[model samples]
Target: MAYTSEENYNPEDYLKDTLNKLDIGFVKVSNDDIILNHNLTFNKIFGYNHEKDLFGTKNLDYWLNSEERNKFREVLFKNGIVKKYITPAKKLDGEMIFLQITFKLNKNSKGEIISSEGIFIDVSERIKTEQKLKESEEKYRVFMETAKLEDLKASLYEKDLLARIFMDNISGFVVLLRPSTREIIAMNNYAKDMGGIPGLTCYSTIGQSENPCPWCLSPKLWKTGEAQHLVVDALDVTWDTYWNPISDNLYLHYGFDVTDQAKREKNLKELNQIKSQLLRRASHELKTPLVSIKGFTDLLLKLKTEEFQSKSLPIVQEIKDGCSRLELLVNDIILASKLESSQIILSKSLENVSELIFSAVKVLKGFSHARKQKILFDLHEEMFTMLDKDRIQEVLTNIISNAIKYTPKNGTIKLKSKTSKGYFVIMIEDNGIGFTSEEEKNIFTQFGKIERYGQGFDVVSEGSGLGLYIAKKILTKHKGAFG
Candidate 1:
């Protein structure tokens, strides 16, 4: 392959070698449109083993269809050259490929065409990439146009074709308006179908107001160049609208009907109001009877006569315990409901954390004694913190009581408290039954509960599943962390 310098080289040999090695397909055809010669690259591209395989093949037959060939010839003949014209071509194997071809007519001295030469570039892969890009762009456009209008901030100018397509395809009212005159410059199919027309003022077409609607956001958009969002009620329907600025002079006014959403919100508010009122009345009605039962049971327990202690004592004691449990359940229900509705307010003050924990433990000591369980604590000496004293007591009571209830008889419950990185942390560990790893995550969710089996006890103290949930909410409101 060694050759002399450029001055001694042959131009024809160099050209033939270069053409054969190029990635492009090179072909020369007679004026009758029959292929006469082709490079190796051309033969490989057309599924031919040799140039002779295409010697008499009609060049026009390579085109996928007669219409495509006719258009290519019409343009090539009128100009004598066609540069990078893209079209589908059929290969010798009958597979279709997209090609970008540049063809030039070779003319003799008499100015008559004698042959045609061209190069073909396989552009199938490029065409596929372009199609994918187009599809992705279409998806993005759809997302932008159909999303809640208030959330959209793109300043789509009128000259952008894709933006135009997006506007045309919108299922709700969309219009571009001239701010000063309120003239509708562009509108989507939905608006047009509703009697909206371009070149008319919005007040005359879509809007029936003598002046701009009081809630119109165009004025703010003109001054701030920021998207304005609002809800307006018209035509017995509520509209959630976005007014975005395309330029200083023009703005996009887009909106969709939100009547159903508005109605749902309204009904929810009314229902919550009714629930609050009913909760208050029910609390009074329910607690009155329990208080009477508890008062009579206490009076009966105070009597120490032989006959009273023998027969009525146990039944009265059971009634008293039932009343106490019912009262606790009622209080929990009320508190949980209030917490969920944000109806409870906290009263915070500087308090001793150790004192709160000890007080809660002492209050529940009788319950642990009944279960034959012991409570052990290793609390910091004097941990002071800002907290709602009553609420934190409630939190401590709930956690300690839960530990007691779940622990087996004769089980030991340990309570530890200390200051960690500016936070007063408390830990309650029981040697009864612990939750699974997955259950721990959702253990505090509203009404989240696990079925309990009474292993070595006479009765299982299953909860209403609101104690920990309420404690978590109270701690959250106080900016305290809980698990």
Candidate 2:
């Protein structure tokens, strides 16, 4: 009833209550082997009626065989503890029963064995299950050892098959070299097929005086611990060679001719760069002459302001119009160069989309006026977003300028900005052309445009074929949405 122990505590009532209510077995005795305690588990486990029936009147060994009693005496003398062990008991009805009992040998103040206390469990089923588990574990251990040996045999067979095929049928020169001494050690059938001279090394076959050529992949193998792949133009054989270290001493080298592929790729890249450069150069150069013509035509308009003659104004406007076309050619080239050189960095800012468009149109007011193209902005003033102001302006300018240059006079170039389907949409509409579906798809691909068509003026000025490509790259970097 009370859980704490005071200095003046008593325990006779507490012990009786616990023994009567709990499922435990215990016994107490004096130095002369007289029973003092017994619990319910003892009665239920061995078919005893009451503690008095098996107490001081009987010897404790009456429940154990002579051999087991001797074992208990010897173990108690040594360890003072006896684990769960089987014992035989004789019941009053003349029936025999078996018990799994554990015992603790207790000593008195004289340090002599007095009586014993113990907690015993009925583990007949548990012991049987444990024995079965022990047997199963041993069998599984044997099975695992056998499976491992079979796996090793299968792995070795696979390696043997690969080695045979590699040696006999592999293409090109597969030579093994000793890096330390720079000597030829082994060669596959392909190596022999290419040049079967004995005592000749990879350096000799490739016409290199040095053992490790400048493009040799041996250094990569040493650094990364993996096969190194690359193409090289050897003095004697132009091929794509893959190098690997088969072991610390032996290097495996193999390759085939790639001269035609190399030549085509190199020439194509150079041609593309040249064309882009022309677009940039043409745009920069034409700016000066166009400025001169537009400036003079404006001077003429200002002089005739008082009595503006419509007929003469139209002729003056025609000259200004020609200058505007030249300016567009220049703008396209400059935009293309920025895209080609990887110099296009889109800067992000929190600003109104409408404001950005208006400012760009203001900057290009003269060009738009000369072409008589109407610039209309369709954006809600309250709508704002985070974007690179200058970059978005440039994109808008490119689309609108192109429309102004290609569309007929008095045509409308509408600039619309709003959100659609979770994206901040910016659309430039012109009757000119919306980049046909096919062109739209490939427009952002670099060298992709050159794969279609750069540099220089009013006659046939085209882009370096990298503006849309570069714009695409920039938008991709910014994670901007594009349809």
Candidate 3:
């Protein structure tokens, strides 16, 4: 702590003694491999007898193994303090201690290697903790990405990855560009697939292109930072182009194939239009029979009296049967309404085949009798069917009504039912006008009807042609076999 002069200085030993009083280990060795000085902590940390091992040895080989000894000289010449160089040194007590030696060299005026000193800092615990922390960080990052994506409900990161994967397999021009400036800085596997846009001063493999490529959605992306989409039939191939903006100045674009989706949408619209028209016609069909059945039943119910015992039972039963027919008609209307918006709910049950068929045929017979046409029913009594009974009756009634309404009197209408090939084969054959091939294509479709008619026999003006359509939907709910 007092003033000192160089003439009276004991610099080397004084420095070693000063370092010995501190918390760390220190050592100094000469270029000729002679141990010169060391601190007290060096012996304490290495478990050495300070009195005996302080200057006992200084050969670099005395500390480093064969492999480390070779690298030791090179490191001393290159860098003074070697990094995490592992070595096991024997103490005066014969105990070996693992050491990490890091130190600096004192070079002389000749620019030659002279002597070196080092700080042997133990880092075993710190290195081990760092490895574990790195592993934990990796696991947490994985978990955070998964949970955060679901909570946010939109995978911004995954969207980037998916867009990359989508473009990878696609054979079209793709680009990631700066939106405002329209600088194309990124592209994918098929970047030049479309002969590259030419003549515009945008950054691309083509350098510049005049006309914005048909697939280019940059103009649209400038308006909205989302996937600006366009469908066009160009170059004899339908292309679905998409533009996705990444930032105010960044966007991605690609053209995909959407030919199939376009065709399906067109067909679906046409089919729905046809179905709407058919429902209009089928509603008319239901009301015609419904009005007569209701009118006749009211009159028949009024006619029955206690005095007329012979005819009373038959008349009451007839009225009850007509009421049942009217109930089925009402169910058809419900089915049509639901089917129009595709919202039909079915009440499926274990069906009595004979009962369901007889109930349906009862009304058909009544109609045939009213029209003076002959009809017969032959059904297997013991068979069973899983079905929505109301809807099946709708199918039968539409066909039977069409047959009887079109057939001349004395025409034969047959209702036949039998189990065959794991399904119920219920065929209603009549010697009346049947539909043509063109008409039969969408026969089960809604709003479809026959064109043939007599004077005042307007088929299109009849009940909603939704009968077959509603019937088909009902059968689907029951898992019923359909033709």
Candidate 4:
């Protein structure tokens, strides 16, 4: 409908029409926080079917926090108006939305508040957009920083190899290229001898390809501005290829023949396989005889006292101890071989850590008692986590037994456990001979035993040196750290 003229226009009708057409929701609430009247936009904004569904409802019911309504009223009363007050509100469906509200206190002539009139715009989408933009900016900033670091590393490496790269008599081939066009800009005598020259495309000159080589690293170098290295086979020769970005448009390419190195690596891998097989075989063969020797030694020790003299009895006990130590060594060798070959699989379950620690201490109690040492425990009442029960117990036993062997007579060993930063941590402390910094670095390696000088106490210094190594591997498999 069209208005005839200004003479026929009604101010109330014009205002109502303008408010109804606006995208914002408008509401008039009573002083008691009850909804008095609202526009069609208000009903839609609050997920109502019509104005009747919302009329007579408490305006405070839509506020996410009732205290916010009181604060809003206080602000309106103090200034008689509020503008662009942003807050969270709940819709009819209980979905939280951000709203930007502007309201004014409608007062009578006596300065008594009557009602409040407000317009609110849903600002949830705008808030979400701003958050996404902020995250994108952060990611871009990180990428630029990483790129700059890579460029600096490339510059340093280029500086170190400047003489070798520029000399024509160098053994390896070196050339400069335009990454965008794959054009060779310059080449040393070594590269020239290999049929490469200026004004020729690298892929055609070296790769003998009509198109760009599939293994070319120029594209990746251009993006990351970092050096790239790979081995490629062309012209019946294996080239250890390297590409480094000199600038945005220039790239340094160099490589040497690695055919001999490749052959040696293959031979070394075969030798390792053979070594592992021999170790497994030897461990298996030694295990059966060692078990028999231990069994016989135990039987002799249990024989009647009248059958042997007291001096012979001690010798029999020594034999049993030697057999036990050998058995442990054989077992460690087998386990190490399995670990190196990736054949060890962990069986995990929820187990009580306290119980596992207790069991380990029980197994090593005899050894500690023989040394006149003390073993103390400081653990939680019941701590449960997912781990391999037998494997974890083995780790605890090995570490505890090592503590017993290294500590002096009458020394105290304490085992403690606690949870920190989402991880279960166990610490073993002992008044034992510790390691030097260099020895500590190699302690976790296979056969990396500490060397001792003079010792007064009769401490057990003999071991296969594989205890800590195996313990470390087991803990690593359990996603736990040994140290």
Best by TM-score: 4
lDDT of each: 0.74, 0.59, 0.59, 0.75
Clashing residue pairs in candidate 2 are 278-455, 279-455, 347-388
Residue-wise C-alpha lDDT for candidate 2, range 38-145, written one tens digit per residue: 666566655666654556644454454667666765765555556666666555565565556666666543446777766554443334434543453354345436
Candidate order by TM-score, decreasing, is 4, 1, 2, 3
| lDDT at 69, model 3 | 63
lDDT of 3 by residue, 1-483 (tens): 332775564534444444565445767888776778777777777665766566847555346365666577677665444655766655556555556766556755343568887767444433443354345335435644654533222344553443344344444556655565565544545654544432222333342344454555346567766567787675566766667764455566656455654654464455444544455446566767777877776666667555457857686777767667665656566566667666766676887767766676687677778668777878777667666677776666666777776676778888788777787877777776556665675556645544343344423224445667766776666677455
Q: For candidate 4, give the lDDT of residue 34.
A: 89
Off by over 4 Å in 2: 1-267, 304-313, 345-348, 352-387, 397-437, 442-474, 477-481
Q: State which candidate has the highest lDDT.
A: 4
- CA error at residue 173 for candidate 3, angstroms: 9.8
What is candidate 2's CA lDDT for residue 207? 46
1 or 3, greater by lDDT: 1
What digit string (tens of lDDT, one per residue) describes model 4 on residues 86-166? 888998899988888988777563446799898887777656544543453354346446555333234534433432334
**Model 4 quality (TM-score):** 0.56
Residue-wise C-alpha lDDT for candidate 1, range 210-283, written one tens digit per residue? 56653354566766778888888876778877787755676777776667657645754654455554554476
Candidate 4 segments whose C-alpha is farther than 4 A from its true place: 1-167, 179-183, 189-205, 208-221, 228-241, 352-354, 369-386, 414-423, 456-459, 479-483
* Candidate number that wins on lDDT, 2 or 4: 4
lDDT of 1 at 350: 90
Q: Each model's TM-score?
A: 0.49, 0.37, 0.36, 0.56
RMSD for all candidates, in order, please: 31.7, 39.0, 39.7, 33.6
Error of 2 at 256 (Å): 6.4
